[model samples]
Target: MFSSSVHYWLEFYVGAYHALKRGYSNMDVLVALGTNAAYFYSVYIIVKALTSDTFEGQDLFETSSMLVSFILLGKYLEVVAKGKTSDALSKLTELAPETAVLLTLEKDGSVISEVEISTQLLQRNDFIKIVPGEKVPVDGVVIKGQSHVNESMITGEARPIAKKPGDKVIGGTVNDNGFIIVKATHVGSETALSQIVQLVEAAQLARAPVQRLADKISRFFVPTVVVAAFLTWLGWFIPGQLHLYPQQWIPKAMDSFELALQFGISVLVVACPCALGLATPTAVMVATGKGASLGVLIKGGNALEKAHKIKTIIFDKTGTLTKGKPSVVQTKTFSKIPLLELCDLTASAEANSEHPLSKAIVEYTKKLREQYGSPSDHMMDSKDFEVHPGAGVSANVEGKLVLVGNKRLMQEFEAPMSSEVEEYMSEMEDLARTCVLVAIDRVICGALAVSDPLKPEAGRVISHLSSMGITSIMVTGDNWATAKSIAKQVGISTVFAEIDPVGKAEKTQGLAVAMVGDGVNDSPALAAADVGMAIGAGTDVAIEAADIVLMKSSLVDVITAIDLSRKTLAKIRLNYVWALGYNVLGMPIAAGVLFPFTGIRLPPWLAGACMAASSVSVVCSSLLLQLYKKPLHVEDVPIPAGPGDGGSNLV
Candidate 1:
């Protein structure tokens, strides 16, 4: 009895004392009550037997000792399982390389010296040399050489991407072949790997809305259980004293009071509030970690809980559904100037413009020069370069004025546009292409038709969402004709065009909406939606406003995020059912509800064992989320055609 008191007092009893002083009780209070009653009662029985020779009772010292042992053992197993649920976060934290090869550069950007140093000491503008099979130490742009990088850990993309000069490399990805020099752009906490780890940690600490029910029940669960146990004892003892049942119904070594004490102890130990407490949190932790591993960075339990209920998703047209990378498809020259000369002049004027269409024209001109065996860099330099928003760019190349823009810029400059040019622009617009009109020396000389292709998985993902009863809507700042054309090709029936940032948010006001976008302009709508998903390649503002980040930037992961949330909620429900069902049925039996019929009764030690098992069972059930797999087979999805393949007419 002394040993049992010491064991229970240090652990369960102490915990119960602190909790009660705070005006509350928990599962520990019930455990302490049950074990203390059995231990002290056994001491009373021993003293009575010693004082009176005719008195007889069976001491319950073993019951109390064994109950504490089983409960403690169950707690140990539960803690171990909970630890396994955060394995993804642990792995992410370990991905950063311990050491890096720092490069010292010359005045002209040539490497002069190299030394190995700890990655923690890295700083912005520091150059690093990465060799084959080594980890990229920080997020940076490649300055020299080329290689293929395996970014599976960071982006969840299994294939190795080819890296050349000017390509950005994320920290913690592996360099597969060749050597490269990278200039650090982001280090320490600013690195992508560190941000991902921080996101996962924050997500695990957040509580799901569904957990409130369990929390409310647990607040009163222990005190209500104590009352039930006392009533159970009264129900058994009073009946026994009245001779309402046969004396033989009692165990051979126990009397009415002793049998009633046994039933009360069973009731106290068998009701498990701990299982109810573990139900939602464990499942949420596992699901968040699983999402991190799959490149879907869920913000927390609230987002995870809400995503499953999304009925409609609003997608920004440019970077969300389309590639966002425009390419020149068709070029027409109307002047006496050759097509090559016109393209060179247009490419030179657009060289300083950052617009996607400008880059497409410049790239197309380079490729054309290459096909003709002319030097790609032979274009004359531009002077007085200017960007006209909603129009285009203006510059001077070789002492001649050059204008490259839409018809608006042409009319603004009083540049003449003939009937043929208007016809060409209409035809291109009908095909969902943006026609860029180029004017040289106040005469319309050429036109370049550029198109941004739809993502290969866009159509299939939309079809899948429709089957799942989720409606897809397209919202864009582009014209109605272009928006509808892109929407039709991607299987979406709804489209909202010429909408600005505020207008995009307004479209999501009356529905359970999830907004997916990738630019600074999309940040407002992203924050206004019920759930915002930002593409990983998007601007930082969009990512900050989003509830989830798709690191792979694949439309398919939109499906994965919703599917995982549905599965997680389902698992939490299952856990609650198991916990409640175990108590509802086990508590009655433990309270001697069956002893009046078949002479069956639950021992205090066995009841304690069942209670411990219930909590452990709930945690183990949640851990099963580690085996989650995305329903879609990414490999079977066909790749979208490139620019050379009929100019990506799908969008």
Candidate 2:
């Protein structure tokens, strides 16, 4: 409320200056100084009447009146500080929808008029239509269509999440593309956004770590001030002894005693303990806000503190450590026939496939034809093409039967293999690649390797983690050769290959891992790991199942989370020092222990000021976190696995 700083400055300080001019002013000083003097007179009268004449009323009354002004100043500062910290809540509320579209009863699914319904009027089961680039109206489940939603405002992740049928949609997320019909499950205060607001409110109501120290000091504060008051009375009273008789010295003695009592109350008035109570939370709130801007969502002080302790990081292969796209890595020849002829046979059989592996096969075949200057539409004998579940296919090529598949397929057909063929397969498999072997008329030929590329940013982020002394591991379902190659490219030393979904969890458990992933199959491992990291990228089932979700799919955000935790912990340490040091050095000054030796006693007013400054220092330090210099760069940071190889041994 003290918005006019100039006006406030001229009034309080000017009044105190004139009052101090009445050299060594007493209760009567206000009476002579007019209204600034009159205010103290009224307070003195009340104290004198209330205390029942046990002690003289002039000084106690004067100081209590000034206490009102000090308390008022404290209240004003506290409100202003609280308002600054709570700005995040107002920003969140601004995301709510102002209007919505309601479905009409026409034969075609038509809209009644565009209804301008306030967010509070929205209810569960309300169907809302969201077009491209609009914040969602309510927390709902998608009933139709698809789109990408930007959830950075809510989850602090920059990645756009893909929302399709059956996906849970949050209110206030921006729709990036396509159209969707959302059936509202929660609206108004029941939404996740509202829940965040409630949590912040509760955090505010909780006791601060510094307040306990203030309470303990305040208990002895009054007694210390009383002693200081007695010293003041003695300094003036002793010199005017009047030959040690009662009647002769009583009048002047009464005057000095009253003045000292007033001084005692003044010290108490100017030294309220409010600032001590606000120190920690203000800093934490500011830190949380700064982290939000940097794409890091720290849920609470506890999580923020624990994050810096991450000693090991385990990465999930698909959609996390890799680019989520598997392609042909290498092609080799074991047969006398041309490579183009083998691909033609393989493509024909895989043309109708929707599987990612099959698509990789088909694409590789097309590329081979283009590279070899052959026609891509080469026809195949469908009669010889056979679909092999969980294996490679068999087809006819140039009037001879050719097989393109795993080594297991050879066993299935009771086909015989020589030592050389097995040796070649062994070398390729060691690289963690998915090898598709070629057999011409039942004779082993060459093999094609399939692999998923490592994400460009994965390497860089992992290296940063390593520099922070956290170990990195890669887990994949690919063969040994392919996994090793990709891991080497990224510079990761630990690799687990050909791991089943269950095996992923078992391995994570064995290593005390923190599993990071973004798929349904990865969910179990994410949950089982010591710290589950779910990478959000529009539709990461793994993120939903994990403990810590990275709303941004970038590996850099993962590193950002780790950095944020460390910095926050640092901030907390500073906070603890501020709290601990203030109390440690503050109590003795308040207790008047030094007055006997040096007479440099700490007045209650000065003690209050020091406590306020310490608190404000903590808050200001936290606010500076907003100016953090590091920008998040997710360039792939390769982490070498040292030679641990890929996948599991269950096969």
Candidate 3:
């Protein structure tokens, strides 16, 4: 019978024994002490009844059962709440299509046949076709046709983007119109969609810096509560026996040693370290999951915790604040060649080049060809093509030497430039435009002005940062005039121009800098900054180096990320305040501080309820972050504004 009885309470027995064996005490040690004291006293009462037959007192079997039951219930509820915090990550895994439609084209470029296959069978260089109202199955570049794809899943951009033959498409976006034939560039896990899901999962599992303090406090809290409970027993029972208190002041029930024991047990049951331990981890989990749903990929908790404290946000001018692709805005001619003919010639020379400016010229020429009929019967391909690094391309079109590039390319061919052409190029540079010189047989024909324009939301994003008191700074390798011109358009006052890759990193030193960039050269600066944010549509090097990645590649997402961080941190602070407040107020009352005055005391069961409620309150408070919405306007209560009645920058 004794062996069977010990088996039912085996966990408590083993826990108490282990605490003594290890010569250390934790929350388990305190729990063992409380339950063992009640259980052993009950056994002694039963022993007296069995031997002497004079025991009429009660055994505290219910006390041990109630303590274990409520604490176990609290732990079970905590695990359930923690699972809900990571729901966003698990939902992302269900987005990709399971199957794809493979396509085989005839030699004449007509569709020969189509086959349905699993997405796992897709490989690089394979062709696939996506119809209207179907999700894309893999990451690839469009080779035929155009469509508007909804990329809300990959990037949080709600608007559908127009995709042409040369545009790249993600794996999970929905195609709205037109049949698109794509040549698979990335398949399976190597796709950008998979990378995003992996990042979200990793971030949710990581620990935040704020959790360190909570963890350190919990290490000492359990043992301290155990000592406090012992002192509470000594304060109440020792005074009652020694006649230290007046007869009128002390309650008749408190005069018994059983009353002192009940008070000590209440203190042990009420002081919960579970709530304190959960204060930071639960908040971080919800914030990271919430960030993933908004297309802001915080790489880990450390980055999310650091984001709210940014004082200066440094922006890379190229792909971050402005469209990285250059577009042909204007073209000037120096000869009798028609404007269309000159454009066709320049486009032909740059057709084989892979530079962004070259692709821009090619795209412009194609758009013009669709609008107006071409002058030539057939477009001849350029031969003997050669690209001079940073200068331009030299090729032969229609057996004539065609040189299309910068001024340095023209100068190498001894192409004489008149003051009229020089003045035109200088004016283009002042407007933040790049001029590409076109020459035929050592003679300068004209210059095509290409400009990488600012994104439409750049001004509003900068204004939002200004309102938040975060200084906006532009860093770029462009010339001073061009950099300042773009910065002025984006509402930025600080400009760091004409700097090399290393110089950009050097500029972020000794400040709480959040560097926003999207290129290979930006990797160093992204790693060196306090918080590095990469554009999702940027290079792999930049994304890997950054701490956070904005998948939408919009400047507006930067504002969203910062606001989310501030709100998340605010939630963490609120949790800490509530948890500490609960312990500070409940511990004293449970220790019988008010029993001497009003004779008000908490029973063990009531203390159990309060302990369980404290943990649930902390979890529920963190769950509120799931409802957080990004403040779109100045009047929407910016998180950096802190909690107050009124403030400026509100409209």
Candidate 4:
């Protein structure tokens, strides 16, 4: 008895004491109460027999000792299972290499010397060499050499992507072949891998709304069980004293008070509040970690809870549904100026812009110059660069007022668009292309017809969402004709065009909407929707405003996020049912409710085992989320035909 008390004092008695001091009761209080009662009562019985020669009584030391042993064993197993739920997080943290090949660069942009150094010493603008099969040490842009990088661990992309000069590489991804020199752009905590780890850690600490129900029940659960145990003792002892049952039902060596004590001890140990307390958090932890592995970063339990109910998903047109990498497909000159000169002025004005369309224009001009055999490595500098949201950009390039954007920018600057320019824009819009009008010195000079192709999976993903009872809508700042053309290609029935950032949010006002986007204009809508999923490659503003982030930047992950949420919520419900059902049925049996009818009763030691098993079982059930798989398998689905094929390729 002394040894058992010493073993359990800190684990149970002290915890119970602290809980009472804080004005609350927990599972430890029940454990301490039940074990102390059994232990002290057995001591009392032994003392009584020792003092009197004729008196005898049964002792319960074995019951108290075995109960604590079983409870402690259960706790150990529960902790081990909980650890298994975070294996994904552990693997992620292990991806970054400890050492990197740092290269010293000369003034002429040539390598001077190379030395191996710890990755912790890496900083922005430092050049690092990555060889075949070595992990990239930090987020950087490839400055020299070419390779195929395996980004499966970081982006969940199974296929390796080809990398060349100017291509961006994420830290922790492996170089499949060849050697490359990378200039680090982000290091330490600013790296994508570090950000993902921090997000997952925060998510696991967040509590789900459904967990509150479990918490509310647990707060009252322990005290209620104690009362039930006392009533059970009264029910057995008073009835035994009144001869309410057959005297043969009592054990031969035990009297009414001893029998009552046995029933009370059994009741106390059988009702497990620990199971109820563990039901929700264990499941949430496993789900969040599993989500991180799949390149879906759920911000917290609140986002996970809201995602499952998204019946309407609003998709931003340019980057969300299309490839977001626009290329100049056709160019036209409106004035007497040469086409090459027209592109030169436009590219110069757009050089300072970060918009995807501006980059496409700049790229096109560079290629155009190469094709014309006048390849120049520099563009004329621009001054007074201005950005008009949802319109275009303007700047003074080479002493010329250059305005490059859509028709709205021309209208804003009162740049006259002649009949030919209007005709060219209408034709491009009908073909699902954006016409970027270039106005030089208040005179319309030329236009570039840029086309951002629909993502190959966009049509099929939309079709799948429709089959799952979700409605897909398109919202964009583009003209109505271009928006409708793109929507028709992707099988979306509804479209909203010419909407600014605030208007996009207003569009999601009255429905359970999920917004998927990758630009600054999408931030307001992302914050307003029931759930917002930002593309990992998107602007930081959009990512910060989103509830979930699709790190792979693939449209298919939208389906994965929603499907995973539904499955996780279902698992949580099952956990609750199991925990509550165990106590409701176990308490009555422990109280000997079936003893008279079937000659069966739950002994105190067996009741302790059952209580321990209940808590362990709940944690194990949560660990099952580690096996979760994406519902939509990209490999299994056939590639859709060209855009406007009405999703005929969906399998």
Per-model CA lDDT versus the true structure: 0.87, 0.61, 0.79, 0.86
Off by over 4 Å in 4: 1-9, 21-24, 334-338, 376-403, 411-416, 439-445, 636-651
Error of 2 at 579 (Å): 2.4
Name the best candidate (by TM-score): 1
The estimated TM-scores of all candidates read 0.93, 0.62, 0.88, 0.92
Output the lDDT of residue 364, model 2. 82
The 10-residue segment of model 3 with minimum total lDDT is 642-651
Model 1 spans with C-alpha error above 4 angstroms? 1-24, 372-375, 378-381, 640-651
Report the lDDT tens digits of candidate 1 across residue range 213-309. 8877877777888999999999989999998989999888789999999999999888957688788988988898888889999999999998999
Error of 4 at 269 (Å): 1.5
Error of 2 at 40 (Å): 17
Worst 10 residues of 4 by lDDT: 642-651
- Report the lDDT tens digits of candidate 2 across residue range 1-651: 455634553454464456457433222222122223234654665676687755543323333233334434554555655666578777877787788775442346465555556667778887788889878978999988999999878876568889899888888889999899888987887775775565455445554434454445544543453455445445434543533323432333245343333333333322333343445565556655565545444455544444566787777776687656667777777667677766676677566656666787788887788888877666575556677866667766567676767878887776677777777677656665566776766776666666655566776777677887889887777666666666776678988887778988887765445677777777888778766777755244564466555655678877777776667567656765674466556555544445446656554345445555555555566566666644456433444453223321112
lDDT of 4 by residue, 538-557 (tens): 88899999999999888899
